[model samples]
Target: MPASLALSPTPAPARGRLWRTLRQWWAVLLFGAVAAVYALSPSSHDARSRNATARLLHATSWQALPWFALLSALISLALIRTLVVTAQSYGLSQFALEMVVRVLLLELVPLGAALFLLLRVALAGDLLPQADPAGGLAPHALAAERWRLELLPRVLALGFAVLALATASGVLALLLAYTVVYGVTPWGLDSYTRMVGRVFDPAVCLALGLKTGLFAVAVAVVPLASALQEPYAAARRAAGFAVRSGTRRVLAVLVLLQAASLALKFL
Candidate 1:
């Protein structure tokens, strides 16, 4: 009896191990999907791609305006004040406004918006399903339609959210920086516009726009892909791993953006 029992093939353990392995690959698959989208982005002239681009812009800008404005204003005030004080201390006040535009507007705001959306929207998606007792769809179906429609859309929305916030904040910060430096006066407009025009050359503008779009896509696509790649049996074990995988995906996207921007600038 003991021999017969021992000889019995326990399929459960084998199945569990297979599930675990698949869960691990889910993260990898998510990263690949984001990369693929970037590579296969609809042509600039393609009507469908154009519409998608327009939708992304509208969603990010109009839908996310209020929250973005509030956050951007708070951050701008803190940064401007610090820059003003620091510049005065060093007798480098002349350079302060330029620095604010270059640092806060050009670099930080966009990245911050992306990160904020990742936390606010992307993380929430992960936690929401877990919190729902009757919440989750069956694993296979969830992997198919749900991921493409529900998860991808939210992620895409987040990308838009970040882009809209960044563009609005960058513009606002420019206005605020001028007021802080030159006071409320019409004379400053010419100088401000010149600086804006110089800073926003055609290439730089294109790069910035592309970067914002990419950031949005990265924030949305990676996490959902990770979750879907896992085997059904390992769903519970896969959750934490999937989040981590998503984070890595975000980081990779950021790095690639920076590299691309640099290459564009130099080349």
Candidate 2:
């Protein structure tokens, strides 16, 4: 056979790409393990990390408060008003608050918070470095330092921000819901408590707690795991493919978790 007809040698780059793909999967699993460990005692992280995280948390939540608060207020009011008005039109005004609580506070707020944080983190880009076997002790120290000072703080801060924003917005939305339904009157207090209590039963409360916590965790972990924790060579060779694939995989996991929660509640 002619030399050209002989099977072309597998290019070094192709082999490298394949190997990088394998390592990416391993990194994903490791991310899950690390994220789980981090979540269990987020309050116990180091002081330096906490300080850095505080700054990030501020950026993620406090700095953006006016816009988020305003947007949430507007949307909540629009939704609550629509529900209340429609309920009254249909002679179901008594159940309007319950509908608002379940739909807005429990469902939309957590999801909207997750998407907002995800978009923010994606724009910030990845800051992690892949472990190099030949890089010796100094490199390991650098990775550890990076993880502690830069990476961990960002991850934790973003997570906490997700929680904070969802919670703050949720509370605000609740207040708006009440005002829209009852016109800020003192007499509605007892009625409000009874309705809220009925809507937020033990099972519902547990589900909302779990869903919000998971949303926070997902927004924090997915972007970091997708971009960081991969070798420079591999990343350079296929940056777009790596990013798109990793991001979709992480997102798929998040969607599955959300689906599981729905199933728990309804199925």
Candidate 3:
């Protein structure tokens, strides 16, 4: 291969692909920044916005917490029991606690929380009301108003739901794992805490936290981005297609994030 040829200007196709990728990510980042600013602005703390946020938060988190906790506890118990039996039979009993922490607490809880919030929001379609910009405001102003009054609160609510559910269910799973693996006694508390601490070292903890935040952001942002991509007329005309495509986008982002997390943790 000639040096000149190798060092020559990049091909058009490659440059085009790179440009497209940059453009896509830039849009996502820009949207996130605008949303964040709106969410944090003092004007957003108005009574109406606060009330909307609180109501949505209650519906998203409180309403789902009990059922989610019950389901997580049952599943955790079954898995813990099975893991204990299997480990004891296979002479790996000592590693059961670590396995539960890694698999159940770090992985399952966050993913399940994100999925639950996604499903709940999907089922309760159009959680945000359409805001009408008064006094013949410009398109940009109307969009800003909508983001502040309508989208920001719902996204905040759903994001809160994801974190709340993940935290609550994760704690419950840990307790259940301990109870099932070591009985209802305080004797194993030290060993259990040590193992959990070991499993959740700085690197693992960082990855888990990042993965959870990414999951929440993906769950909250993808649908909104997809909805915005469609013009009002087209969205109204092909609502089902818009929904199906949005779901696919959300799932793709989630799977990608999960794969990256696993790679970071184990690779």
Candidate 4:
């Protein structure tokens, strides 16, 4: 082969990108495993860890209450009204409640919660404090300190935020859906409940629970993993890359999970 041909850079081999993706995924999995172990371990319940977790939890979930509630309500109302009108026009009004429950509560709520927290965390960037890894502390001690003081609290807060937001929004959406479909009469409550109950059978309930947990994990773990895996020397650039890549991967996973749930339910 000619010198130029042999020495010329290969077009950034697909293998490099593939390996990066695999590494990211491995990081996520490892972080999750460690988090679970730490959460269940004795140290997690100590006063300092518990206090940090409480503060972060309050920041992520409690402080977001007003905006989250408003946004969820608005989205639910718009979607519910649109579906109800369309159903009425098509002479399928009877199925409107079921459709609303499936689309808004089962689907949108979890995804919206995940996206909301993801955005919140992204906006509040630099969640982890700057630390010198070479500051004479042992690797294991430093790792433990980082986990207890920073990573665990933040991850737990985000996960809890997802769960809280989804649950609250889902309940509100269900109530609003009923009101939109059947008006504000107590008599309609029985039928509304029945329709919702029928829509959410055992299999669906399981799937919804599993999907919510997965969404939480994706939102909580992926970004932190991406940032942590990058070199601390170029923290700023690493953060930008982490945010972009993590957001894309999280969105892709969310879409895939939603699609799979829909397929299981309807296809």
Candidate 5:
């Protein structure tokens, strides 16, 4: 064998595959950004789109509101009672309501909203138009109309759902915190306002809003975008793998957003 004929370590194919993978991922991210922007922009604000958005708000958020509200109230009660009791035992009862406001509103409720949409709407897109007779359309054909009619509304609903549910539960927890702490007296209102207001300063409010928005986007995009790729329905049959991958991606995005938020805040 001649030295010139020796097989060199050809990195081209591997690097080409790597670049292709990166490009595909970038395309998916671009699609999600465009989709979110379109859904939010004035161009998608026509009457029919508005109606579709309303229908989705009804389905994704309103219909689930009662169940979520009840469940969150019950959960809040349990947590509030536990925190109050624990704080009382430790003689930190004066700080109990503040703790409740901070823990329940600033952290837990947003996390719950993220999980709710991930389970309820984001990954449920396959079941949206399927089981219907007209769902046999090809992937390319299902791009625009299906996305507009079926996908965008649901994504918007999920975002607003997170906001609505988080705000609702935050209010509920605040009231519950007051009730559990002060026993239905109006005299504690001033102190309650001061404590909650102090904790929820403008910066904290902005951060919480930003966190929820980021979480909503993470829940909406990561799973749905992955599941909405070509051969959509067949992927449903292999849903276990799809779900695991989607969950990992969602968690990764969420972790990054959370870290960035924390960095901006404390670091």
Candidate 6:
């Protein structure tokens, strides 16, 4: 009787674990499919593709627009002010705007947006829900639903969000720099536009877009992958382990993307 009772629960746990594994794997496969389609599709003007793109753009832009714009503006202003003061201190005030654009827009904005999404959307909502004790679903079902509904949208959204924020913030930074340098006049627009047109060559634009997309994927996909890799029973305890693993994965992706972008630029 005692042996049978012990063995009974063992089967249930095993069954639960197998189902959970299947669900996790399915999620990974789905993610791969989505990513492939996204990458391979040409820039399209056809209604279907355009609508899909617009939907993605809208979701990413509209969902977080107000907050992201505000944050970017504040950060840009603070950084510009600091750079201006530093440059003035060194008697190089003329170089401040150029420095701000190159550093803040070309580099920091996309990376910051990626990290922000990872924290706000990916970590706080997506992963946390997967580990929720009272979610009231079985482990496998919960994992599947989380991946399908939460993770997929987040990965897609973050990718688009980063792009939107980068483009929007880049323009804003340029404008802010102009106002600082030229004191709110149209006189600087021609020079500023020329600089932008020169900087945004085909290669640089492509690289920027690719890097932003990869960052989004890294932010959204890695954490879920890590969480899925954990044992269902130990999920809560394993959350930290998963997070560390995900961080490493995200870093690897970032380094590889950066290296690839640099290599492409040079070659």
TM-score of each: 0.65, 0.77, 0.82, 0.89, 0.80, 0.65
Q: List the residue pairs that clash in candidate 4.
A: none
The digit string of per-residue lDDT tens for model 2 on 1-267 reads 998878668978999999976776666557656656554655537788778778777888787678778888988888888888898899987777788898898788988777776666555544223433332122223354566667677677778888888988999988888787778688888888888898889988888988888877766766666666545556666556545664576577668877887787787
Tens-digit lDDT track of model 5 for 1-267: 987678667668988998865754664586577676677677667777778889888877888889888988899999999998999899997787788888888878888877776667535544233322243232334456666776677667767887888788788888888998889789999988999889989989888988998898777666655555434446557556556656777777777877787688777
Point out the worst 10-residue segment of candidate 2 by lDDT. Answer: 131-140
lDDT of 4: 0.81
Is candidate 4 or 6 superior in lDDT? 4
Q: Native-vs-model 6 lDDT?
A: 0.65
Model 1, 1-267: lDDT tens digits are 588787747688898998865664464454446434543544322554445545655654565678768887888988988998798899997777777787786677778878776666445543222312332233333333333434434445555577667777887888788888889899988877887788778877777787777777776566555555545566686666757766776777777886777687679
* Superposed model 6: Cα runs more than 4 Å off: 1-63, 88-94, 127-151, 259-267
> How far out, in Å, is residue 236 in model 3?
4.7
User: On a 0 to 1 TM-score scale, where does candidate 5 land against the true structure?
Assistant: 0.80
Between which residue pairs do clashes occur in model 5?
none
In lDDT terms, how accurate is model 3? 0.76
Cα lDDT, model 5, residue 242 = 56
Best candidate per TM-score, number? 4
State each model's CA lDDT, in order.
Answer: 0.65, 0.72, 0.76, 0.81, 0.73, 0.65
lDDT of 4 at 181: 74
5 in model 6: Cα distance from truth in Å?
48
RMSD per candidate (Å) reads 8.6, 5.7, 5.6, 3.2, 4.6, 9.7
Kindly report which residue pairs in candidate 1 clash with one another: 60-160, 155-220, 159-216
Write down the worst ten-residue block by lDDT for model 1: 127-136
Better of 3 and 5 by TM-score: 3
TM-score for model 6? 0.65
Candidate with best lDDT: 4
